[model samples]
Target chain A: MEPKMPRKERQIIATTITLLAVVFIYGYIIYKKYILENPELVYNLEFWGRKFFLMIPIMIGSLIILMIIFAIVNKILTNQDMETMTDEMDKLIELKALKISRWSTNICFLLAIGSQAIGKEPWVMMAVLVISCFAGAIVEAIAKIYYYKKGV
Target chain B: MGNCKIKNNIRTLRFMANEMTQQELAERTGVTRQTIVAIENGKYSPTLELAFRIAHIFNTPLQDVFSVDPDDLVLKKK
Candidate 1:
């Protein structure tokens, strides 16, 4: 309506992008500083398993906190409520965006499995899996923004 | 066809209805204001039920509220 991203959705996307950036930076640091320091950890399934398991809760917690902060700031700045009605169009756009995200993630999953089936290292599969998930999420967010601004 | 678009008279209808606001229309139609804006601007098309609801609100037939582009029909005929 404003020729820009709707306020509530804009904040959600902004928080998502911010959290994604933080995760990427954190992953990069861990890989470069910690994993490289202990090369054996790369081949250790237990280490990867723990990292993946811990990351899920941490990511969720961070996202919830960020969303709350954004909501508070938005209320202070614009005096608009965070909650909004979801209508048919919103549902339609969400389904379309989700379809795009699913396809991208599925393709990456196949690639990851194929790498494992071949002779690629275990770490390669793990990296591909992680990247595929993040890429799918980012793509979904971008698709939502596009559809919201340009119409679905 | 991709070339065919559903044109609507929502803007005219709103204006004729004592300059009804998009927010009011949205509330009457059980949707968001942005959704009403999108429909009026022809950026999005409503579903059959939604079309009926809008027509009901304006006390018009569905055909009066929405129609296909005549040019598209000509292209189809060609």
Candidate 2:
């Protein structure tokens, strides 16, 4: 039998997966409907800048909305407020996950720069940077889940 | 470094203390219930400060609540 996980862990896993889907699906739709259609914009710094700028608020809004809905549902089901207090163990686990995310992000930065140095298009570098950030976020979530499940 | 393992008797102590629930122990110790569960299951070891706090809550000596497993203990040669 699978061991039951804490409510907080389950919340993290669900939110991370849902956010990842929102990001990637939104990105793909934009790439297909807008960028692909306007092939010229692929090399346009201004166009990429506008797209990147728009994405930040959209992602942040999605996260805030998702958290609100998740918290409401969680509260109704569990009849407990969200665990907000940070204890020693929670701090340790968070630090470990942050370390993993930082390292992954650094490596991704190196790879993105390397692509640019190798004469890749500006879009390629931007794509690498964006994808690397998403990868780091997902990796941190996975690391937290692993540590929570298997012990720190 | 290879064989450092901590063994705890939190579950037993809680039982002896009038069948204290994990939630009760966690609230008294200022930690989440999942953390208490993890300690009981041997999935995570508490820090020294937390260990002392747990011992204090049980009104027991620190060594009584937590100890190095004898089988995993390593001694250095002088």
Candidate 3:
């Protein structure tokens, strides 16, 4: 019988597989850049669309395969232990976090719209998106801290 | 928000039950490992259903698993 790999080893393997996928995608972008630079190459929306469709399947396949491997490895390492369900406490925390994220996102989006209406630069919209993400994370973190401090 | 307080003996019971692992308890209680850790640390409160499940797992009555502390009460007479 083959020796079962430890949880740490399995996690490393899974992470490596994910990283490999990212690397492969980045390499494809470099290749596309090279093609775009070539005078002989004809670039059009249809050509790029075809490339995107091909890439999607490869990405999806890799993700599914990686997930399956991760599940198998996790099961083996944990001795067939089932995944734990989220308890009520976790649900409450998650609900609070989600509320924070939603409020932040909504407020940022509204502010961005207002800025646009007030004749702000087009690039300002990008800043809004970035700030929204940051604000969401901050709000979630603050909510967690507040709830913890309040003993809820 | 309404103040809802619940007290539980999970920490003491876990120690008496041969120092059972939090992960093991979480699995048995159908909750996330982090949730169990949070509950044990008194950082989070569980729902009624989850509380009953936990009580069932320890083979104890619901009152034994959880209680409302009188000290946590804040009275308001209308």
| DockQ metric for all predictions | 0.73, 0.73, 0.56
How many Å off is the CA of A115 in candidate 2? Answer: 1.3
* Model 2 regions more than 4 Å off: A1-3, B70-78
Candidate 2 per-residue C-alpha lDDT over B24-71 given as tens digits, one digit per residue, 9 for 90 to 100: 999999999889988888888898888999999999999999888675
Q: Put down candidate 1 lDDT per residue, B1-78, tens digits, no spaces.
A: 555688999999999999999989998999988788889888888899999999999999999999996777664443
lDDT of candidates 1 onward, in order = 0.84, 0.86, 0.65
Better of 2 and 3 by lDDT: 2
Per-residue C-alpha lDDT of model 2 across residues A12-114, encoded as one tens digit per residue:
7877887788778878988898888988988998887888888888888888887888779778877777777778878888999989999999999999999
Query: Of 1 and 3, which scores higher on TM-score?
Result: 1
**Model 3: per-residue lDDT, tens digit, A1-152?**
22354332344345445645554565468457855576343334354445546655766677677767777766775666534344466457668877877898899988878878999765455457545755675676557555544545
The C-alpha stretches of model 3 lying farther than 4 A from their native spots are: A1-85, A130-134, A141-152, B1-5
Worst 10 residues of 2 chain A by lDDT: A1-10
Clashes of each: 0, 0, 1
Candidate 3 to truth, TM = 0.56
For residue A33, give model 1's deviation from the true position in Å: 7.2
Each model's fnat?
A: 0.71, 0.62, 0.86
* Residue pairs whose backbone atoms clash in candidate 3: A85-B32
User: lDDT winner among the candidates?
Assistant: 2
- Model 3: per-residue lDDT, tens digit, B23-71? 7898788776666766776767787788888888888888887777776
